[model samples]
Every structure is written in structure tokens, then in C-alpha cells.
Target: MARFRSICNTLEVLFFLIFSAWSLGNRGSEAKDTLLAGEKLRDGENLVSAHKLFEVKFINLENSQNRYLAILYLFGYDGRAVWIANRDNPLMDSSGVLSINRKGNLVLTSGKGNSTIINSEEPAMGGNTSATILDSGNLILRDGERILWQSSDYLSDYTLYLQNDTTLGTETTREKGRQLLDFGHSAKRKLWLQITVLVLIIMSAFLIAFIICRLKSRYCDSGGNNEKNEENDTASSRLQLNKFSDIEAAYKNNNASEQKLCGNKDSELPLFSFSSIESATNNFSTTNKLGEGGFGPVYKGKLVGGQEIAVKRLSKMSRQGLEQFKNEFTLICKLQHRNLVRLLGCCIEGDELILIYEYMPNKGLDSFLFDPMKRALLDWRTRVSIIEGIAQGLLYLHKYSRLKIIHRDLKTSNVLLDCDMNPKISDFGTARVFGQNESQANTSRIIGTFGYMSPEYAMDGLFSEKSDVFSFGVMMLEIVSGRKNNGFYQTDSDLNLLGYAWDLRNQEKILELMDSTLVDSCSTNEFEFIRYVHVGFLCVQQSAADRPTMSEVVSMLSNETTSLPSPKQPAFTIGKSNIGVESSLSTGQESVNDVTISVMNGR
Candidate 1:
């Protein structure tokens, strides 16, 4: 009896300690350094580094109620945000949540289902994944023990940084919801509130059903079928039957005509209604149409908020419509650059596939560069600036961007000019992302403007950064001489732009090729004009190995003193101007921008 009493006392003490630890954990004192797969980091929860110097959590930037997942300084009261995950996309309200999906992808999803950001790379071990914050100030996404990705790689150009702890608790989330519910001017807030209430009610229903299941397992073991039990079981089954049959879910699927937009689950694109866009584009009226391109008609629009936007509507009859739309939307949405055109959002209602972009007041470069009267406006200084800007933008795409991309269909029309004549690269439907070590990729479908395509890409479908450089070279020549390369009919030596430029460079009379409009103004400094012509030749070299990388191109263009390598004889494959031109031309379209679909060569 004495020994048993002693054992009982020890057991009680052990139980007391365990209970205290659990209580402390519940009170937010649990210092967890890792989040396992299938688990979640709630709006206010945090993951701290092992050394506690760095922490990551969703913080409301400046208490603006716009929450972002950011790295924060753990030990300091003074706030500092060094790196942000969703900087481009902030959680609108408290409904934002971060979790590891079943596929082991890191996902940040907002409450109202508006925006969903997913980081999907290598597959985690069947959801047996983990996210850890290390002393090295790295947030690692892991699959079991395998390291899938690291935040350090994403922010290599940036130094380590963080902010003060500002995690939202459950109560805080509720309070945020309440504030938005009562204070928000938009009806969307009320809908968000409804979503929150529905979530809570769903959870409650799940708990009740679980309890009922447990009771049935225990009480119905003897196969007893009493009246009350039968009625209860019948009612429980009925509830289960009705659980998935919500009116909203049914309506969502049935509303085909409304086409209430929802961005693809993987993409972080915003949904825009068909009606709103119709209003913005003035009912897609003929007068509002900006111009037609290979994709479709582009319309200038003004949103209800007084923001101007350019809308690209894909042709309904185009064969490559869906694939091109997905490619442009998914790829361009991820890339951000001053030289890159920004996609505001897209509207996909029924048969209409439309993309909205930040409106460029001056329209495409071709509008000014090729026109005899407008060409006078582009002085030597402006042309040089445009060339440098294009080079820098291509450099970003090739080296600086998170993914190395090749802009396959690069030309004058795809380059839009802003209010200040700043060039922004657009029309990325044919752009392809390359692996870190990949030098080039092959495609059976030769889809790009004919004259601008490099010989290698034009003949063999081999494309890389060099192919874009080749295109840039052709455009540079056109900008200087005010000539169009598409079906370029030359009476002199039967040479295309590349061949003609090559011939001029060999004779050292590049000044002859300069635009006639700028002859008197630019004659004082034939040196600058000749140097640009020299750089253009280097870019259009026959071999991809001969063409300088965009970074080197920028350096050469910037520093006139930099000695340039003599360019080799280019391929000059357009033996007859119309030979390859016809093969690359879109069906039933003579003008470059008229066709809404690219000619595809079957594999």
C-alpha cells in the first residue's frame, strides 16, 4: 500500500508538469521553429529562427490592414522588413492564410478567394513536408528531409533583414473581420463576412458529425436498432447528404452566362467581371479600339475608377487562343520590370478572352518610328535611349529575372512607348522560360515575326537569348534608318536589312544608312551614329556564339570607348525577300498585326 501510494504521487506530479507545459503552449509561449506539411500558419501565427534573431509572419504593413508575409527582426522593438513574400500581393483583410497544400506547395490564399499565390517547384514527399526558419535567416521549404527551395535564393541581390513581431491571434482575425464588415464601403466586405460566418458554421457542423459518429460506434456495437437510434441515424445520414449541396456552390457552376471571373487556382491573377470591362471599353465599340494585332483587337479603356487601361481581346476563331492566353497570363504575371508591360488583370467571360494592361499613351514604337512625319520626332538622343532601354530590359529578362526567359517574338510593334517615349516590351505569348543551366530550347512550332527571327531559330526552331538579340539588332537598324524589315524590298544588291547593314559596315559608310530626317542634326557626331551601327552588326552575327550577351551589349552600348569585336558575315538567309516571308505569314493576313493566330508547324 505504501509503494502504490508513492507511485500514485509521482504519476500525479508528472501529469501536473505535462499539463503546465501544454497550458504554456496554448498561451503562445511555444517556440516552434518548423511547420510540417499538412499544417498551417494562421494569420497571426509566426515561425521564428532557431537563434530567434529572425522571424517570419504575416504583418499588416504600416497597420494599413494590407497584410504581407515578411521576414522581421525578432529581438528589436523598432520594426524592419527586409524581405517580403507577397509584397506584390497583400492580403486585403484578415482572411489571408498560409499553408502547405497536399502537393507540398507553399500557398498563400486570401479569405474571399480573390487571390491565391502558390510556390510550386519540386514535389514534396507526398505532403510529408516541412518549412523551417534557420539561424542563417533563410526560410526553407522542405519535403520530409529534402530541401525544395530557400528564400535566400529568391533574395540573393538583397541583404538579410526582418521586423518586429506582429502576429494576428484568432480574436484579432475576428476583430479585423468585424471592422471591415462594418466599415468597408464596398459590398465585397459584406460577402467576406458571410464567408467567415460560413466557415465557422461548417467547422461546427463537422465537430457535431464527428461526435455523432463516435456515439454510433460505441452504442450500436451490439447491432441494436431501436426507434430513437433509427431516427437519429436517418437524420445524421440526411445531414451528410445535404452537407455538399450548398446554393452558392450550385450557382457558381450554373452561372455560365454571367461568367463571373475566377482566376485559375494556381495563378495569383485578379478576377474582373465581363460587365465591368464592357463598361470600361465602351461596349467594345469600334471607335474605342486602339488597334488589331496577331492576338486580336486592342481597345483603350477607362475603368469606373478613372484608370486608363489597354484591353487585348483574343479572336474567338483563333486556334492557338487558349494556349497563348495561358502562356501570356501565367508567364507575364510573374515578371515585374519597368521595361515590361504590366498586366492589370484579365476578363474571361464565355467566349471572350481579354487581358487588361496599363495603357501606354503613345501606343507602339512602330506608330512613331516608321511614320515619315512622326519619325522626325525621334531625334538621335531619343533613339539611343530607346536602344539602351531595350538592351537593359533584355538583360533583366535573361540574367536578373527569377526565371530566364527568351522573348521569341521581339519586334518594333511589340515594343510600346510610354508617355515619355520609354519602351516597354510586350506580347509575351511566345516567350519561354529556361532552366538555370539551359542555353537554348527547341520548338517544332515556328511562331514569330519573320524578318526579326534569327537564322538559327528561323531554320531550325532553336531559340535562346541570342535569338532575341538578333531581333533587337534588326529593330535597331530599322530605328536608325526608318525602314520596316517585314518583306523588306530592297532595290540595292537585293539585300535584306541584315545583309544591307552588313554591306554598309564592311564599306565603313554606316552614315548613309542613318535616317534621312536626322542627317543634318546627327552629321556633327557621325562617331555616335557609326558606333550604334557597329553594335547592331555585332548583335546580328551569324553564330549565336558570336553575339554578345545582353549584359555585355549594355556595357558596349554605354561605353563607346569599349573596343568591339569585328562581326562575322551574317547568314543573310532571306535570299528572296518573299521566300521565307510567305512561310511565316499568318493565313489571310498580309499586315503583321492583322492575324490573330500564329502559323503552327505540326510536330
Candidate 2:
């Protein structure tokens, strides 16, 4: 009996030791909740939320071999993907990895070695950065407690269905209750039917009220004064006749221009009634006004369906007349590019002329580029992106688009930013279309921001693709230096931003022209910084022939191996004498002469 008891004790001890070892091994190999810097989440591996509600891993869609890094729900839905990292550029094979790079960017690399930065704005470097899949199904990259990027901010097309009870058993039970489910579905159908009937009844009531109001007005007109009503009717008929005549003439001209350019009869531009615009803008409320440009006051408006828009109303006192309005309407209707602002429709009633566009929430690039506080938000990466976007936009206009267009008013204020900080070139009122063989054109009326105009265009009224290149270069310098070219005079040398950049380049101290806020963000990428400045110099060369074309500019920006040619001295490097003359004129005023010039100041 004593030997048997001893044997039992030994077996119990051995079992306890084996169980402890097994638990330790499982704990070490279990799925992690966060991915740290330098640690990669491989194709087969995943990071799960704390409560195991969400998971982030590599996935392939149905019947598609291409793989994507996505965040998905873990329970009740069998891993339905909520957000995808590389939706547009999916991996060809299953070999994929996601990690936080040294620069604090969340990057996804595919089997072919292509990388995509998931973060919109590169986070500032510091601390141990990590990525976590939250219980809310949001994949977030964080530096300690501060979130550097979140998947919620950038939603995908996939809809996420949230459930109060997230359990497999509950889902199974619900699935089994088919009769109850059918009854609930029937209840919903009945509810919808009732709502539809209610809506119809309400609509009928409105129609009846409208008819009664019309009858009342007619009865009053019949009883009050027949002779007065006749005179009023005659005057109203004449006014309407003139209005219709003007509209018909405008339509005919626009149709002819559209036929010559687009040749698509079905691509008709929508015409909004003036009353609808007034209602959208709340009768042009002072609070709804965005700002007054050279043309007129712009207002922020929302349509009945919750679509936000920007309404550009032409002022009677504006220097831009009917010809300019018509020119803008006809030209913009035919041109379509991702970088160009989208014109929703237009309104022409009586003397009122308005153009409606998709509202840009972030407003103009100048609003952020020149603002002291907002400029800091635009780091080196974002500025480079903006520069590249604008370059592509110009390249499309100068080469790729159906109709070659010259954005005569390319300035900081004319470049608008979307919610994602993507740059869209706006203000096509001064833009001109170029023929297939036409290289340059001369115009007596010079309409553009003073600092942005090229020397050839400013002096001899000769404008071409090179002229736009000059303007782009000036803008590049401004974007890099975070300073406006116009009205920017150095106290000592009386030099503007352009001349200062040139003088710095001569001294081989061009890095000093960089924005102070960019120092930390671009410390490791000094070569890229200098390269951009060099390209800016190349674009702003004095001679139009010396400047690179938009295509070459884009190539130089995109390809690192493309060698750039030496740039000559830039034009209009105004000194103290010139500054005095420029300062004397009122800002935002047109030159009162045969050579009409609209001067735009830095706002």
C-alpha cells in the first residue's frame, strides 16, 4: 500500500510539470494585439483586438488571386473586411507584409517589392510607434497614446455592420429561428408601405395648397384692376422675352463651342434655375459668403439632397464682363480632369449669372500655405505630394487633356485643396484653349496675379507653355520657402522671394531658403529638398525657351535619374525701385489702360 501511494504522488507531480510547460509555450506563441516598429505582420499572421472582436491580416477577395491587407470583424460575420490598405494596388500573390518604417510611416509591401504609404500625413518621429486593431474595427497606428493614423478617417467602400451581441452561438440561434425572422421582415415591409402612403398623402396636400394659392392670386388679379393687370402682364411678357432671348443666344453659342470641342451631343451641362440657387445660398446670406474674388462674391451653399456646392456669383461692378463669364462657362464644361475643379451646373436668370462647383472643404492652398499656424501642418511629404499633384495637373492641361488649356491664373489662391489635402487647380476664368499647332499667343488684356506672371507674358504679352512653367516655378519656390512672391521685399537687399532664392543659389546656400518648419521633417532628405529647389529654378528661367516644358518638369520630379539642365537667371527680380512702384498701386486693382492687367495680392 505504501509503494502504490508513492507511485500515485510521482504521477501527479509529473502531470503538473507537463501542464505548466504547455501553458507557457502556448502563451509565447499566441496571437499578438499590437504590431511594434520593426516587427512585421506577415501574410499568414494577424493582429487581433483585445476582446478578439477585430483582426488585421492579409486577405484575397472571392475568385481573385490578388491579395490585400485589410481589417476585418472576427466574430458573428466570418471575417468581413471593413478597410483595405492597398485596394487600388493589390498584391499579385499571397506574399505581403505590413510594418511601421523608421520614418514613422505605416507601409505595406507586396511580394513584387512595391510599397504604399497608408498614412496621409507622415507622422513626426519620436517614441515607439505601433499599430493596433481596435474593438471598433479601426486599425490605428500610434506613437505611444497619440494616434498618428486611423483607418476610420479613410473609409473604404465596404460597409461595416456592427452588432450588439457578437457571438457565434447567438448568430446560429437567430438563423435557426426562420419563422420569427420572416415575421420581422414582414413587419418591416408593412412599415415601409405605411411610410410610402404617408409620403404620398403629404405630397398631395402640398399640391392642393399650391393650386389654392394660384387660384387665390388669379381671383384677386381678376377682381382688383383689369387695366393694371394688363399693363403688368405686357411688361412681364417683354421682360421674359428678353430673358429667354439672352438665354437662347448663350445656349446656341455654347452648343457651337461644345460641338467644335467635345462633339458629344449627349454631354449637356445642367442648367440650374436662379430661384434654386437663391434658395441654396439662403438669398446670398452674408454668412454664406466665402470671399470676394476679382470676378465676384463666392458663397457656400447646400442643395436639397445635402450636396455642398460653391456658388460664384458675378458682380455687376466687376471688371470681368459677360464675355469673360461665357468664356469660363464654355471652356470649363468641356474640360474634365481629376485635378481640375468639377463644375456642377450654372444659373443664368435675368441679370444674375452664377456658376456652381463641387465645394472644397479645405478651401484654397493659400489658406494653409501662407497661414502662420496652418503652414506647419503641411510637412515635407505633403508639400512634395502637392507639388507632384500640381505638376501632373499642369501636365494634363498642357499635354494629356482633349483640349490643350493654359491656366493663365495659376497662383496659390487658385489652387484649392480637398478634404484629403489633394490639390485641385481652380479659377479657370482666365484660362485659354490652345490649338493643336499653336505654341504661343499674345493678349492685350493680361489677367493674372502679378508675381505669378512670366516675363514674356508680363512684358510683351506673349504667353505660352513656358510662361505657365515660370508661374509654376514661382509657386514651387513659394511652397518650399512658405513665403509669397508678391509684396515680399527683403529690408536689406530689397529683393523679393524669387530674387532671394536666386541669390541663395549663387552663394550655394539655397537650403536657407527652405521653410523653417520643414527642417526637422526633411533633415534626412536634404538632397531631395535641394533637387526640388533646382527644378524650381529651372522652371523660372528668364528665357521662355530655357524653361522646361510641363512634361519634362513632371519627369524631372518623378524620376530621380533624370539629369536636369542648368537654369539661367530668372526674370522680374524687382528691387527697391520696382518695389516702390508696385507698392504704390492698390492691391487687387486692374490697370486702367488699353493693356488691362488684373493684379492679385497675397491674401
Error of 1 at 522 (Å): 2.2
Best-matching candidate per lDDT: 2
* Best candidate, TM-score: 1
Report the lDDT tens digits of candidate 1 across residue range 1-603: 222222333344334433432342244425787888667787888887644546778887765878889776553324355457887777788777777777777788787674446564676654577777754345777664345677654321011111111432245544554564455335545654665576566556556665666676557665666546656766765553333223212222212111111211112354589999999988999999998755678899999999999998887665455556666766676565688898887875545678899999999899999887999999988998898888888888897664589999889988999999999999888789886568998877777776788878867778999999999988888888888766565676677776777777778777789899888778787898888888888888889999988988899888989999887876663446545544553442333454222655522
lDDT of 2 by residue, 1-603 (tens): 222222333343334433432332234324577899989988999998655656898888766899888877654447767567787788998778888888778888876895855763656456588887755566777665445676753211111111122542245544544554476568747755775575566556556665665675677677875657655765766654543344445554443223222212223466799989999999999999998766788999999899999999988766474446666786777565678787887887666888899999999998999999999999999999999999988988887564589988798888999999999998888889887568999876667767888877766678999988999999999999999888788999989888889999999999999999999999998999999999999998889999999989988998989898888888767655675434533344563321235743222
lDDT score for residue 214 of model 2: 61
TM-score of each: 0.60, 0.58
lDDT of 2: 0.73
lDDT of each: 0.69, 0.73
C-alpha RMSD between model 1 and the true structure: 19.5
* TM-score, structure 1 vs. true: 0.60
Clashes counted in candidate 2 amount to 0
